[model samples]
Target: MDLCLFVTHNCPLGCSYCYSTPKMDVNMTLETAKKSVDFALSHSHDEFQLSFFGGEPLLMWDLMQKATAYAREKCSEKSIPPVFTVTTNGVLLDEEKCKWLKDQEFHIAVSIDGNDRMHDCCRTYPDGSSSHDDSVRGAKIVQAYYEKFELVSVVTPENVNYLYEGVEYLIKEGFTDITLNPDFYSEWNEAQLDNWTEQFKLIGNLYIDCFRNNSPVRISFIDSKIITHLKNGYEQCDKCRFGLDEMAVAPSGNIYPCERLVGNDTGEHIIGDIYNGFDVQRMVEIKNGNGFASNEECLECELAPRCMNWCHCVNIALTGDMNTTDGIVCFHEKMTIEIADYVGGVLFSEKNPAFMARFYGLR
Candidate 1:
């Protein structure tokens, strides 16, 4: 997990659930980007994920081009991990950018809520017009070249009932791999447990439906659990690439733990200056002590062995305590385990040994 880099904080959409809401800053300069990449490549890791995140990555394609070139130059010096991916709104991804993405071997994940109505409900241009059309067009533009990619739908109260409908639309659009993560902006409470249960029920049924139809899309969190169940892994703790295993460099040549933590009033300083050659000592200090202490829950969870604590950024934003509202998240962990156990048994049971064999490598 080298790090997930956020190219800039400039976004075109006015998504209501933008967790980085109050933290949104302006564009990162091209000069700063070059230096940050320099530091990152200097301290590259094997199997690293050089995730390009954004307001929208295309906004700084010039800087990204430099960073990509820097990665190649340094990796040629010594072996490093693959370039992980870029997650975007898919509004500006064009044919030229698509070619560059394929050339760079970058895995892409686009954010699309669902159909035009549901998507527009949350996703809109700063000008307040519907962004669904442009985003879909951009996605179609990228899909012309890329066959299978990742998409995450941010579910909300308004769209919770439409989970199945959204899945249907995504499958029809030719997406083979997709991930559904419900909106976390909604505060956590025992009262909302009913809503959580009902929404996740839709999510579970969506998986069953996909299997029944042999849908091509791979739902992220759920599919991950399926792999985990077969692999004998217990919990699903994958989070933002930047959270646990990743770091990020803003355009100012300042490096932070991840983009989510960057450009915010958290008063967390930019650990290192790429131009100053990545103050390794300072970065280590920031990455180790109080700054990183917010991940204590992940460090102490019983599931820590398998599930890395997911998102400290969101956890901190929602709950004043980093422990997740006195382990409110544990409910989700419990529910996921229950659901995974049920679905794995029903859909990929010993009776359907072929499914299990293909999916889990179990005979």
Candidate 2:
């Protein structure tokens, strides 16, 4: 099981496309944190991950420490090793914090859009000052302490042209695990979409070249798709055990299906709370409700079997209707599958047998 603790709804940066409403000023109390941890621990059997999430989880540093300590104690008693992780914008990271994070064995994911100009375009301070330098500095500190960490960059229409540049910058910065995610909910015009497709193909070629030469590179978007293609001809939504295997806890102790569904106001999405436990029936309804029965486009498409439709949260965000699929998101999904199939076929057949070993880290 994976339990995400939304430590707080407070953030220092004012990224233009931020999904969380950081102005709400909601912080998870220690009492609520303890209860949420206890609830998750009790339900977990062998191993479980405790992910610290938020508008900026580091803002509630004190609460995070307490919760982690409590979780560690409980897990020790239960004889289960605890796995911890945090996803942050990298503004508040310091040497001390980096040391503590490394000591705790927390898998950190830092948000950096790309180069200075591209990153500073939207990731700015509340006063509209540039956050590029500070963010890079923080990332460097974390990297110095922890050899492995994920660099997560969001790609919007405005920055679509910089896709290759952004990834190149992360590679130069010594990051091996990188993820460039397109903002599916953002309005993408023809020009932006065209640019994104071209850049994506260029990046795919670069990945193949790197693999052939045995260079360290792992782009999550492309790599995940390739892995899915190799294992199963396509991906399926039911394989995503969100409400069952993973859950997100809000500041008020309310439990949600996932992190994306945390701040959403819809009452139907709230499966259960720490005080009451999971609503198994509601969870089943959510999982069963995510198939192609509702989306006519998916039902008729050739990729339906291998497709994982826009997640319910993304669907609601883009269309204001959870049951509906967004045209733009669907377009990106189809393109991704097509590209993954092509890339996987080329690498599997033409490349050296060691290519898969190197790509998958068995080498």
Candidate 3:
């Protein structure tokens, strides 16, 4: 089971596409955090992940520290080693924090849009000042301490054209693992969609070139799809595993299916509270009514097997209906799958023996 603990909904960066309700000054208490951890440990049989999430989890550093200590102690008592991860905006990270996180072996994910202009356009300080430089510096510090970390860059129509450039910038900055995701809920017009498709193709070609040259970078969005296809023939439902095997606990101990639905007003996404435990029936209903199950159009589409459709949370955010598929998101997914197929063909061809050997770990 994967437990995403929304430690706090308070953040310093004013990201334009931020989905969290950051105005609420909510922070998870140590007591609530411990209970949440206990709930996860009890429910999960063998292994479970404890993910620290927030408007910026680092904002509640003290609470985070306490929660980590408590979780470690409880996991030790239960004879289970805990897995830790943190997703942050990387604004408040310092040398000390970086070293501590490295020592603790936390899988860190830093949010940065791309280059300064693209990142600062959306991710800025409350005072409207740029946070790009500081965020990059933080990423550098974390990378210096830990060899493996992920850079998550959000792509909006405003910055979609610069997708390749942003990825290249991260690579130049010594980041090997990168994820570029579109602002799923944003309204993308025809031109933006076309541009996004072209940019994706360009990135795919670049990725292939890098692999051919023996210097491979992992672009999570594309690489994951390719890997999944190779492993299972196609991508499955891109649903948020909320309510099912995954759960997101708010600071107030309210349970949600995922963090994106943490502040939803409809109340339908709230399965149960940590104290009361998950309502099994509600969880069943959620799984039964997941995005893949509800969208008949998606099921019938040729790309359904490999397409990375929006999750329920993103579908709800984009179309105001969990079952409805966003046209732009659907288009982007198809484009991404097509590009992945092309890259797979190139990498697996007999002509590219060296690349294939390297890609398959034979090298």
Candidate 4:
């Protein structure tokens, strides 16, 4: 299900790390929006999702209203309604916008790091001051308006040191759900993994704290990992939602599985033109692991089944092969697995009291 009818490419803030390669350089038009919704319903996807992302989504706020209404009407015609999600920088979110999102019951993800210093380093405006203050304000309004919204912090080396502080701040801000991602807008290298470990370790501790405090906020990383550990699946993802062959439509009506994959840096993955119709069979092939991608070092990892080689975007960035079999991952599955094992021994089996003493690999 192409849950993303990627609305536009034009954004107000010029973030240095923005990774946008438009299928066509255009703004969202009402007719194109209608056609996109029609395309989704045509597939009879049953339950559909429409997510608004952008250079900055609010830049096209008026267009979004029209598209949202049209999507609803299209779904009605197909005897199915659409669920909406928006990922925004929060520069433009205000009282009225929040009311509309709440009224529509859209799932929203706001972008912000812990404090001003961290937030500005990765996300900024043309003048390059920092969007931290405004983003925080917008996040507040959005959270009040949309109960299910979340905050996504783009992790950078500079901000990596502050992961604990950011987590504490987000929890205190009343946002229970958060996504802390490595800042991919920059180049990938070995140096970044150390930062990721620090962040993940903090997150693991946060889960322990959550358990102790009876926190209702869902920590995606640890909670999902726990679920996967219990179910014999992925550490965070139960099933590869992207593996299901989801698509992202650009402003000009071109379709691809995800925005990250749609970058001009690699355009062969763009399946079809939305103006016509998506190649359903082609899409199925890609979704089912039949698509062409180069798998690099991942070809040797033992954790392939669980991690599925991590994400395609991350793999390409790290190893230059979007299709690496077990290409390195963000959370460091090896580390997480070790942590999970240690957690089991310490928290479950007092039979292994020497756990901390055993970061050393046993003979």
Candidate 5:
């Protein structure tokens, strides 16, 4: 089981496509955090992932440290191994923080959209000043401590044209693992979608070139598609089982299936709270109400096996109905699969050593 604690609702930066907008000055209580950990451990059999998330989780540094200590103690008592991770906007990540995170063996993900021009398009400070430099500096600092930290890049329509260059720049800056996210709520016209496809193709070419040059990297969007193809469809892990394998706890103690759904800590869509325990009936309703099998169009579609249409959080966030499929997600999956197959085909045909070794287990 994976448990995420929304430690704080205060952020220093004002990102353009931020889902947690209208940020508040709220923080989670240390007692609530410990109880959240205990609640998550009750669901896990052997291992658990405890992650810190927020408007800026690093803002509540003391809470994070205490919560981690409490979780570690609990896990030790329960004989379960606990894994830790944190996703940060990267502005507040300094040397001391990085060193502590490294000592704790926390899996870190730094948010850096791309280069300065591409990044500053959406991620900026309160005064609208450039946060690009600070973000990049933090990423570099994290990289110095951990060789395999994740670099999360959110692609918006404004910076869609720079997708290929953005990824290439990250690779040049020594980031090996990258995840690209699209602002699904943003307006995307046909032209922009077409450009998105082209940019991905350029990225595909870059991916092949990297492997050929002996410096292979992992791009989450592309790697997932290729791996899904290898498996012939989306695996069990690929699909989201809302409130089942993973859950999030808001600063107010309201429980949600995903962190993205915890907007403003509103009581809407809350399954339960730390004090009340999970609403079993409501949880069943939510889990049963969503899936590709529920939608007739998805049932009839040929790509149903590999499509991510069953993600309830994404569907609800974009269309307000978990059962309905959004055109944006449909289009994104199709384009990504097409590009991934193309890239996979080229590398497979050439028998790229690194690709073969990584995917095919060929020594």
Candidate 6:
């Protein structure tokens, strides 16, 4: 089971496209945090993942330290190995925090939108000043400690043109695991969508060049498509199981199916709390009703096997219904597959050793 602890609903940066906006000063108490760990462990049988999430989890740094210690001890008692991870905005990461996180063997994913120009397009301080430099500084500090960490760059319509440049900048900065996430909920007209498609093609070329040069980077958007093709489609383990196998615990101890669904913590999505455990009936209702089985259009589509429309959280975010998805998702998937196939064809024809070995087990 993957238990995500939303340590706080407060953040330092004021990114415009932030879904968890209206950042309040709410924080998780130590007791609630410990209870979250206990609840998750009781449900999980073997290996488990404990992720620290937030409007900014580092805001409640002290609680994180205590909660992590409690979780490690509990996992030891249960004889279950625990995996720790955090998703941060990269501003709070310094040498001290990075070293501590490294010592603990935590997997970190930092949000920095490519380069300063692209990042500052939406991400900024409360005073409307740019946070790009501080973010880059923190990311560099983290790089020095952990051999590899994830860099998540959000792609909005405003920054669509800089997609290739932003990734190029991150690659130059030594970031290996990079994710370019498109803002699906935002309005994307023909012009922006066209630009998005073009930007991806450019990045696809970059991906090819990098692998050929033996300096490959994992860009999730492009890499996932290639992997989907390689796997013949997403495996059962690769898909999101909603509230069944994973759940996000809010600071208020209210449980949500996914972190994206934990907005304000006052919605119908509340499945259970840390104190009482999951509402079994509620869990069933969500898991059954929110899959591809619920959408006839998706089930009939040829691209259904390779598409990402099965993610309930993303569906709910875009269309406010777990059973429905938008044209943006459909369009992006088609473009990604087309580009991935092209890239794969080039690498295969050339018989690139790394590509052949990875996908075909050919030396």
Candidate 4 RMSD to the real structure: 6.1
TM-score of each: 0.82, 0.90, 0.92, 0.82, 0.97, 0.97
List lDDT for all candidates, in order: 0.65, 0.80, 0.80, 0.66, 0.89, 0.87
Across 92-205, the per-residue lDDT of candidate 6 in tens digits comes to: 988988888998899999999989888888999878899999999989999888888899999999999888899999999899789988888789989999999999999999
Model 3 lDDT tens row, 1-363 = 688899887898878888774556778888999899998888887777889997899998998888888888888887888899999989899999988887777999999988887787788887889999989988988888887889999989888878878877888787888898778777788898888888888888888887777677888767866765776534343445656768889887888888778862236578899899888887776766764524678878866656555476777677766667777667777777788888878888744655566456665
Residue ranges of candidate 3 with Cα displaced over 4 Å: 232-240, 264-268, 290-293, 320-324, 350-359
- Please give, for residues 327-350, the per-residue lDDT of candidate 4 as tens digits: 245345665655544454343343
- Over 4 Å off in model 2, which ranges? 234-238, 264-268, 279-281, 290-293, 320-324, 349-354, 359-363
In candidate 1, stretches whose alpha carbon ends up further than 4 angstroms from where it belongs are 22-25, 45-48, 81-84, 188-193, 234-245, 263-266, 269-272, 275-310, 320-328
Candidate number of the best lDDT: 5
Cα distance off (Å), candidate 3, residue 225: 2.3
TM-score of 1: 0.82
- Give the winner by lDDT: 5 or 6: 5
Clashes of 1: 3
For each candidate, C-alpha RMSD in Å? 4.0, 2.6, 2.3, 6.1, 1.2, 1.4
Best by TM-score: 5
The weakest ten consecutive residues by lDDT in model 5 span 287-296
**Candidate 5 Cα errors over 4 Å, as ranges:** none
| lDDT tens per residue, model 1, 163-278 | 56776687788876777765665655554566667666676776666666655246666666667666665433333433235567765556666576665424454555556654
Ranking of all predicted structures according to TM-score, beginning with the best and ending with the worst: 5, 6, 3, 2, 4, 1
Candidate 2 — worst ten consecutive residues by lDDT sum? Answer: 232-241
Q: Model 3 RMSD to the real structure?
A: 2.3
Report the CA-based lDDT of candidate 3 relative to the real structure: 0.80
Over 169-282, each residue of candidate 5 has an lDDT whose tens digit, in order, gives 999999989999888889998899999999989998999999999999999878989888999888777786678888899988899988888878877779898888899987
Q: What's model 6's overall lDDT? A: 0.87
Which residue pairs show collisions in model 3?
A: 242-257
The per-residue C-alpha lDDT of model 1 at residue 188 equals 59
